[model samples]
Target: MNKSTINLPENTIFEVLVTTTNNQKPHTKPFGMKIQDKQVVLTLFPNKTLNNIKNNKEFLIQFTLNPLIYTKASLNKLTSKDYQNNNILKEATVILRLKVNKIIEQKNNDKYGENIITTIFSTVTDIKQENIQVPAINRATTKIIELLVDYTRYNYMNSNQKTSYINKIIESENIIRKTGNKNHNKSLNLIKKELNIED
Candidate 1:
C-alpha cells in the first residue's frame, strides 16, 4: 500500500486484548497505540486496563486486526469479548504478554483538546509468536504519522519539525528491521526504494 492508502485507517481505534491480574480472564479494550522501538506503547484513559496496571503492574497485549472491532472501537461502542472459559483466537496476530514497570501521566492542553496522557511502560514477559508470514504493522500508527504530516501544512513549523516527524516514521520502520520482521522489512525497503534512499 502507498503511504496515503496504508495510513488511511489510522487514528481509528483498534481492539487491544489484555490479560490483567484483577480479572482471571482476558479483557479486550479499544486502544490507540503507537509502535516505538519494537514496543507497543499504549496510552490509557484511566480505565480498567490502566487501573489494573496501577494495581498489579502487568498485562498482556493482543493485536486484533478485525475491521469490525476497529470500527466499533472507533465509535467507542466496543463490548468486551469474554475469554474466561474458552480462549479462542478471534483476531489476534501476535499476543505480547507484559509486566508494567512504570507509569507516566502528563498534563497537556492543545488547541484541539485538553486531556491527561497516561503512558505505560512495560516489559514483554512472554510472546505467543504467530506463524503468519505477513509482517505485523500497526496501521493506526502509520496513519497517525501521516495525519501529523498532513497537519503540518496548516501549522507553521520549522525545518526541524518537519524532519523530526519524518524521522519518527523512519525510526519506527528501523525498529521493525531490527526485530527481523519480514513484512516490515519488505515494506521499509519498498518505502526506501520509492524515496530513492536505498543503499
Candidate 2:
C-alpha cells in the first residue's frame, strides 16, 4: 500500500470507523489512527475490537468521512447487512486490510487507577477502493470528530467537564450546519439523543 496516495497529513490523528470480527461476527468501532509509512498505528485499551484483533490477527479500516457510520458503530447498532462478505463495511470508499505486525504493552497509571494499554502496529496487506473519495479536512467534520472523542468520556467526567463538552458539541453542530451534509446532521442528532443533550 502506498501511504502517499491517501490525503491524510503527515502526523494527524483522524477519527475513522474500523471493522473487526469476534467469532466471525463483524463488529465496527470508531478509532483515532495515524498512517505512518506502511503501517497504521493504533493505541487501544482492552475493548472488543482490540480483543478481536488479538485472536483474529487482522482488521479492516474504512476511509470515509460519513459521521452516520460513526454513529451506528458508537451505538453498537451495526447489522449484518452493513458489512460485505463478513469482512468489509459496505459504506467504505478506500479500505485497508491490515495484519498485526507488533504489539507493545504500556503500563498506565493515573489519579483513577492503573491499567494496561496496547499499542498496535499493523502492516497493510491489502488496499481496496470501492470508490475514490477525498478525505475531508474541514473544521465542521474536525469539531464533530473531536466531540465524538469527548462524548466517549462523558460518563466518567465531572459535571463541569461535561458542560464544557456539551458546549463544544453545540458549537460543532453550528459548524456542521454550514459545512457538512445531511448525514452529518442525522449522525449528530443521533449522538445528541444518545448523550441526552437537552435542547
Candidate 3:
C-alpha cells in the first residue's frame, strides 16, 4: 500500500502476520512492517524468517487487529487455523502480497550487539482488504507497541536514552489511562510487570 492508501500513526510499530515459504513449506510469523514510498520496509534480525525470505523473495503481510493473535505469533505458538491458504492469516483485516525489491544487509556493533541485520524493501503486488472500518484512534495499539519497543531497548540504552524511553513509557501509560479499555489496561499492566516497572 502507498502512503495515501495506508496511514498509520507516526512511529507506530505495525504488528502483522508475515508468511514465508521454507523448503516448500509455509511458515507464519509476526513482524513490524513500515511504509516507505510505495514500498514496505522490514528491518529484521537473523532468524528463520530472514532465512526464508532470503530463499524466497515473496511473502505476504497480513494486517490484523486481533491482539491475541499478535501475542500468539510473538510467542511462536500460532495455530494452523490462524493461517488461511498458507499465505494469509484468517484473522487479518487486510492482506498485502509483496515481492522483495531490495535486501540490504548490515552489521551493527552497538544497537544490535554486533548482530547481522537485514533491511528488506518489498513492493506491494496485491492487496486484499475485508471492508475493514478504519478506527479514528488506535492509541491502545500504539501504546502496546511502544511499550514493547521500550522494553526491548532497556538494556541497550545509555543513561540519556534510558531516561527518554522510560519517559515514553510513562506517556504511553497516561494515554492508556485516557483512551484504553479493559483489554488495554490488562495488557499494559502485564507489560509493566514484565518490564519490572511499578504501578
Candidate 4:
C-alpha cells in the first residue's frame, strides 16, 4: 500500500471512525487520524477501545466529513441504534476492515524521557465503495469552513499562508456547489464576503 494514501490533506482534518468488538458488544468511536504508509495511526489513550483492540486484534476504520455524526461520535454520545440502519456507514467513501497483527507499547523513563515505539501493523482485508450518496451540502461545507478556520487559528499560521489557505477553501466550496450542493454555496458566499472577493 502506498504511504501517501493515508496522508491528511493540508488544512483539512479527517474524522476517523473505528469499530471494535468490546465484551461481545460493538462500539464505535471517532478519532483524528493521520495516514502513514497506507496505515491509519491514531493516538488512543489506554481506554476501552484500546483494550478491545489489544484483545480482539481486529477493527474497522472509516472516514467521513459528516459534522453531526462527527460531533456525536467524538463525544461518545451516539447510540448503537443510530448506526444500525444508517447510510453513513454504508455510504462511506473509504472503508478499511483490518486485522491487527502487532502491538507496541510505550514507556516513559524516570529522567522525564518518553520512548516512542510505533509500527503496530494491521492488514487490510476489505475495501469497497458505498452506493448511498450524500452531497456536500450547506451544513457539511459550513462545518468544513469552520474546521479550517479553527485549524488555522490553532496552528498559528502566517498571514500569507492564511490568505492562501482561505483561497483554497473557497475553491473547494465552489467545487461542492458546482456539484449541485447549495449548502456549501452559502459558506462560499460568506467566505467571499469576508475576503471581499466580488462574485
Candidate 5:
C-alpha cells in the first residue's frame, strides 16, 4: 500500500469530489480530512458524499485556501465555470486520492443531537501537488467552514452546545489575527457580522 505523506493542518477545509453512480459528472463538496500517521480519516454525517463514497469506494480531496470556494461550496452553489477552470484543483496546492479502508459508526451525541455519524478510514492511493509555489498558511477560510458546520448543527444543539461552538469561533479568531492577510481578515469580518458576533 502507498503511504500518505502530506502534512495537513487539522482543521483545513478540503474540496472533495465524489463520483455518482448514475452520472458522469462528479460531485464536488467541501470537507475536512483528518490526517493520522500515514492514514486519512473523514468524519461525515449522512450526506451525498458519504453515501456516494460507500457505493463508489473512492474519492478525491483537494487542498485550497480560497475563501470564496469554501463559502460557495458550503452553500452548494459553486458555478460550473469554477470546475471548468479547474479552479478548485488549481488553487489547491495539493490533492489526494483515497480508497476506503474502513467505516465506523458513532451513536447519538448530546451536543449536536445528530442521530448517527460515520467515520471513514481510507488509504492514500495517490497524491498530486498541482502547484509548487509558496502555499498560503492563513486559516481563515477553514475556520469559516468550521463555523458553518457548527451552524448546521445549531438547531440540534442546546444553549451550552451553541455557546461552545461560538467559543470555538472566537478561538479561531486568534489564529486569524496572527497569520491572516487582508483577504482573510475581510472574510472573517464578514462572517462575524453575519453571525452577529460583536468584537
Candidate 6:
C-alpha cells in the first residue's frame, strides 16, 4: 500500500508511537509527526529516538488509541509484550515502515526556549494494515499528549513553565474525567503521581 492507504489529515501533526532498534534492542517513544507530500516528517531534540534513527535510518510508526501504551512509553516502562516482532507496537491499528529521505537541521524558538531540532523526512517504504477502525477524536487524548510532552521537561522548566505545564495537565485531567476512558485516566494518574502532584 501507499501513503494514500494510511489516510491521515494532511499538514496536521498528530501523535504516534515510533519503534527503533539499535544493536537489535528495541526502543519506542511517543512523538508527533505530520505528513507533507506523502512524506513522514518530525523534528526531535537529542534523545534515544533521534540517536537510533541517526544510526539506523529506519523506524516503525504506530497509530494507537491506547493511552496505557502512551503512558508506558512516556515513563520508559514498555516491556517485551508491548511489541510484537521487535518493530511493531502491539496496540497499533495501522503501521508504517518509513525510510529516511532527508534530515534537516534548524534552530527553533518556542515558549520552552531555543534549541536545534533535527527534522526527519522519510518515504513510506512499507505498510501494515490492521482491522481499520478509525477512532473518534477526543479532546482528552490530544490534551493528554501535550501534557505528557510538557511532563517530560517538567523538571527542567522554570517556575512559569512549570505552572503552565501543570495547568495544562490539570485541564487534561478535567477532560479525561468527562471524556477519557479508564485507560486514559490511568495514564494521567500515573503521570500525576510520578510528578508528585497532590490530588
lDDT leader: 6
State the number of backbone clashes in model 2. Answer: 0
The per-model lDDT (C-alpha) reads: 0.51, 0.78, 0.71, 0.55, 0.66, 0.83
* Most accurate candidate by TM-score: 6
lDDT of 2 by residue, 58-152 (tens): 99888776677777788787787877774677788878888899989899875335768899898777777775667647666676677777766
Residue runs of model 4 more than 4 Å from their true location after superposition: 1-13, 85-91, 108-119, 131-199
lDDT of 3 by residue, 1-199 (tens): 3322455554455667788877766676667878877578898877788899888899878877655455455545566776667456777788778889999999877653677779999887777776486645577767776566455456667788877776777778887778777757766666655556786
lDDT of 5 by residue, 62-116 (tens): 7666665555555555555656332234455566778899999988666455478
Q: Which residue pairs show collisions in model 2?
A: none
Where does candidate 6 stray beyond 4 Å? 1-5
Ranking by TM-score: 6, 2, 3, 5, 4, 1
lDDT of 6 at 164: 77
- TM-score: the better of candidates 3 and 6: 6
Per-model TM-score, in order, reads 0.48, 0.86, 0.68, 0.52, 0.68, 0.89
What residue pairs are clashing in model 1?
none
Better of 1 and 2 by lDDT: 2
Following a full C-alpha superposition, what root-mean-square deviation does model 2 have from the true structure?
2.8
Clash list (residue pairs), candidate 3: none
Candidate 5 wrong stretches, greater than 4 Å: 1-4, 7-22, 84-88, 155-199
Better of 3 and 4 by lDDT: 3
Instruction: State the lDDT at 173 in candidate 4.
Output: 60
Q: What TM value does model 1 have?
A: 0.48
Per-residue lDDT of 1-37 in model 6, one digit per residue for the tens? 4453567778998888988898898888889899899
Report the candidate with higher lDDT, 1 versus 5: 5
